[model samples]
Target: MNATGEGEAAPRQIEVLASVRGRVMCMDSAYDVDEANRGRDVCVNSSYCGVLPARFIAEHRPRAAIGMDCGVGPEGSAIAGLWYLEALGIPAAVADVMTAHLGDGVHLYHHGIVSFANQPALDCGVTAGMAVREAAALLLEHDPVAAAASEITNRTVMETTPDGRSVVAADSIAFGTSEDTDRNVLVTAGHTGRSAVPYLRRCRPFGFICSDGGRGLNDSGMAGLYLVEADGLAGATVDARRARMGSGLSHYHDGIISAVNALAAAAGVEIGMACPQAAHHLLHRRPPTASPVP
Candidate 1:
């Protein structure tokens, strides 16, 4: 029993109930919207089959999902929700289904089964489910085992602007054993040429480490490299890159090695080469473009 004299259930139970509630609510709301929209369309078509309706169905209809914001305008909000779940000791696999609400206010709604093993109840403060009193009770009843779960999955929300593109970054630490440490490498695929360049420039002799094959740099003109001292990455590299780009969209070809370097420099840490062949193969395939010798 919990402080409130109620029996505490497992986390899995809480998730199951929440999932059921979310699903039912979502379905009912969607059905109502469809019915209203359908009725309106039928009326319009009956009135004038040859001409378009005065009001289009999309213009007057509400979305099927009440709290979801899947449009471009809400991309940042969606990403934020994903990060939030990750910070709570949940892995990305479980966090992906959570939806973000961006109407008049912002909120996250979990629509999956609540299980002690996977979707544990949130600690007391979260107001996503209901008022604190009800939310706490529900959580305790559903996911009592959460208290014993590992906290290593904790994460932090970060806002990053890569090449003038604003992105809500979710940063997490992934540790490795001695056996895996020697093979650890930082791998990033290039959508723009600048992706791997900044790190190479900042690391110098150590440079960014890469796998021997570097097969991951599939994009044309893309490059990849490994960080020799993964521990020494500070924020200097990223800052420099951001400064160079200014306000407008960054050129696809400009590598942002400098920005990554800034992050490494700021952290006062260095990362080791985990995969040299992968880096070499990628860089070799799309060698950095040359500028006229000054």
Candidate 2:
């Protein structure tokens, strides 16, 4: 038995065979000799792969032989075992993908265990249970609280331009020091399909200038960039962040923070480098307040 209170034995394999048998029975060609021969071959193979080994242990009582014969070795045997288990209605457990950096190149790993649910595919870059665990751990390394805050405060808006062009607008929050306090607001909107650089240039016409996220531009929408502002900006930023995180707007490969940062940079804004926990608290820790600025 596994953790979920389900048996480790194969059960779904029987269900598959039952389904196939039902289909065969309904077919007019079921009486064909060739089909009959094929069916016999399938049954024999299924029995050899599925029923025989299980029955050997359950009925014959040859304990040592069962263990020895069932030992994992060649891929062919592993495949046979998998097919057998499938035939027997047994479910197998598979691994998840893992990503790792070694020197310069990235490495993919896989788990060895078999599973029916959550089965990792080839090219999934996972090979072992340990690899799946490690990948999960790596993902969790980012502070959930901070990620939540980031997601809430950043907003990505899509609009159509006057010239029949689709445009994307991104607004975010930024900090202002006493010396340069022009209510440091980052407002970046651009032609939707083009790269960030051209979009930044377009926004420049509307007093949206600055590239605080970084030096170069990333055309990939996967990047997180947001336009920043001051005044009611902090509150708006916090509120947005809270709303997004609460609504489950952020997701895998979405790069919410990266997009926010990119937009902030394009708008020449400065953002506070707060810890993820602190950011989360800032976004969700406060109560609602009425705003006079529209």
Candidate 3:
């Protein structure tokens, strides 16, 4: 897909986890897939295999793509993306939320256990319970196809807090812009992983919240909180069970707090508070000056 449009420079490389016959990349969100690495395989810690992310990967036409199953929540919405990719004849699969941290791609590659595989992936020797590295090897054996139209989901300003800050709901933090700055509070449906740190550090929103991804394996799901806290961003994650993993609107309306960084705690966010309440406190307060990055 020409989503990047004519003359768009190829996007810079995201973290490359391995390079065999083809590159094996790991990213925080599926939106990280781009024209630059069009045919490489990727594993993202978006915590859900929904069509939104699938479309992002399919748009780039990767040889294969893998994402977390996110407990295959209500209506199986979490793993629904697998079928979407299947229809496009792309090899795609998902790791069990329990076997790997939902937000850490490196962990997914090294420790994840495949819980589901679409027919295309299955045809290439990918199977449930297989090691991610083994599945990625099989993925490389598949041929890349022409790009499909990519769908970019839009973020919504759910409400303007009493203090004038916008409380934005985004299907993924990947939609955030530098304009969000200290003027907006973001509630995203993606996981809080280490890959999220760089994006948050760059965007510098007033405050932010995302999913805990069931706090899977070594608490890797919310691991980005401390990393961002070091940058002085007040951040938190809501329990995956309390809200859908891939819907920001569901997060804002149904989420219950699962964890909070120090800055968020200082702002009165608690583990059991409703997401709206926490977002309110975040909009009303600001973290200390973030340490300058190199």
| TM-score of every candidate relative to the true structure | 0.24, 0.19, 0.50
Ranking by TM-score: 3, 1, 2
Least lDDT summed over 10 consecutive residues: which range in candidate 1? Answer: 42-51
Candidate achieving the largest lDDT: 3
Tens-digit lDDT string for candidate 1 (28-119): 11122234432111110101100011122123332111122233134244223223332343211111122322211111223322111112
Candidate 1's TM-score reads 0.24
- Misplaced by over 4 Å in model 1 are 1-24, 27-67, 72-75, 85-174, 188-294
RMSD of each: 18.6, 19.2, 17.5
Q: Which scores better on TM-score, 2 or 3?
A: 3
Stretches of candidate 3 off by over 4 Å are 1-151, 286-294
Candidate with the greatest TM-score versus the true structure: 3
What is each predicted model's overall lDDT from 0 to 1? 0.24, 0.24, 0.79
